[model samples]
Target: MSLSVWVPIVGLLTLGALFALFSVGIAPIVGPKRFNRAKLEAYECGIEPSPQPVGGGRFPIKFYLTAMLFIIFDIEIIFLFPWAVHFDALGLFGFVEMVLFIGMVSIAYAYEWRRGGLDWD
Candidate 1:
């Protein structure tokens, strides 16, 4: 490929890097300098943070299930965006493949739902 085609990509990358660096560099200078015990402590969604056990206690299985479900749905979105962007080019074969993929994901979701993976109680 010609080097000209890479110019826009390189420009965007440079712009992104500069923006990130600028934000990080400016934050400490312009942001709040006040510090207190509460500000230093770990935040737990606005609730008082609990002390960690000495043994680093195992997390409930529900946490893992929730994380796995998030990953599953995230992957579904990742696949879907590309397919949707190229829908016209992909045609019927792609449509069928996506249908099968969605069906499989749906089955997995149903299985988890039936297994109480979604229940908090």
Candidate 2:
């Protein structure tokens, strides 16, 4: 390729690096430095600062199951987008590939359903 193409590519990469560096650099300088006992306490995995509720309020498994389903479907949609955009050019081969992909997802969905993973109660 010509210097013209390489120059712009290099300039863009340099600009992107500078932008990211400046963003991170400015945050520490401008952001608050306040810290307390609550802030220092580990949130998720560490010991709970508060007492547990009555019945030890259990978290429903359905929440995680639904989130997993959303992630799987979201990924399926992402892959389908490019295939959809080039459907005309890809023709039968792309169509078959997409069908297979959908079939696999469907099988997974069926398995989840059969295993009671989709149940709410």
Candidate 3:
């Protein structure tokens, strides 16, 4: 609403936009343009690239499952951090809620463990 409040927000946003534009614009000139078989190949963690079908080949279902589990746990940790910071304000009700939340997470974890979600082999 006010100049003092709006100016800083707009200024920061403009700065961010300028930085992004500069990086994307200058990168082609400053960065390498060399393209060979190795450079064109998709990165596969430090492993040698293997020849595959036209569309980069099929991904294993296990990779999807593992990624979903990682995202779930990552979100769970995010909630925990905010709850911990406001622990005092939440008091007994928050404590009970957190316990229930933790219980649900534990159940899901146990189910995954029982179903071999944690197994690599």
Candidate 4:
């Protein structure tokens, strides 16, 4: 395109890069330097950490199942946003496509539910 079109694009990219560099570069110098047993220890994945395996050496399958569910729903919601925003313009074709997409996802969800993939111990 023309210089006018490219100028803003280049400026925006440069600004984003500068902001990321500044934030990451300043954090080490300005943030806390203290380190002790707790700080050095592996995080407990949200629960109270101990000097042992985070989940008592046996990881919970529920956590992974929940994470996968979150990702699946998250992606579905992301797709819905664009379709929603352009619903009127997309008309019947878009509606049918979205219905098919939802149907496929629903089938997968039903399969998972039937297979106990959504269940927790």
Best model per lDDT: 1
lDDT of 1 by residue, 1-121 (tens): 8999999999999999999999999999999999999889987533456787423665656767777788879989999999999999999999999999999999878877876788976
> What is candidate 2's lDDT per residue for 1-121, written digit by digit as tens?
5688799889999999999999999999899999898899757433364567423776555656677788778989899999989999998999998999999989878876776777765
Clashing pairs in 1: none
Candidate 4 clash pair list: none
Residues 6-96, model 3: lDDT tens digits: 8888999999999999999999999988889877788864446667643467665566667767876987898899999999999999999
Query: Candidate 3 or 4, higher lDDT?
Result: 4
How does each model score on lDDT? 0.85, 0.80, 0.81, 0.82
Query: Could you report the Cα RMSD, in angstroms, for every candidate shown?
Result: 3.8, 5.4, 3.7, 4.2
The residue-by-residue lDDT of candidate 4 on 1-121, one tens digit each, is 5689898889999999999999999999999998898788767566666667755687666666667677779889999999999999999999999999999889867866776677655
Candidate order by lDDT, decreasing, is: 1, 4, 3, 2
Q: Which stretches of candidate 2 lie over 4 Å from their true place?
A: 45-71, 113-121
Clashes of each: 0, 0, 0, 0
User: What TM-score would candidate 4 get against the native?
Assistant: 0.62
Stretches of model 1 off by over 4 angstroms after superposition: 1-11, 43-56, 87-92, 115-121
Single out the weakest 10-residue window by summed lDDT for candidate 2: 45-54
TM-score of 1: 0.65
Candidate 4: where is the Cα deviation over 4 Å? 44-59, 89-100, 103-121
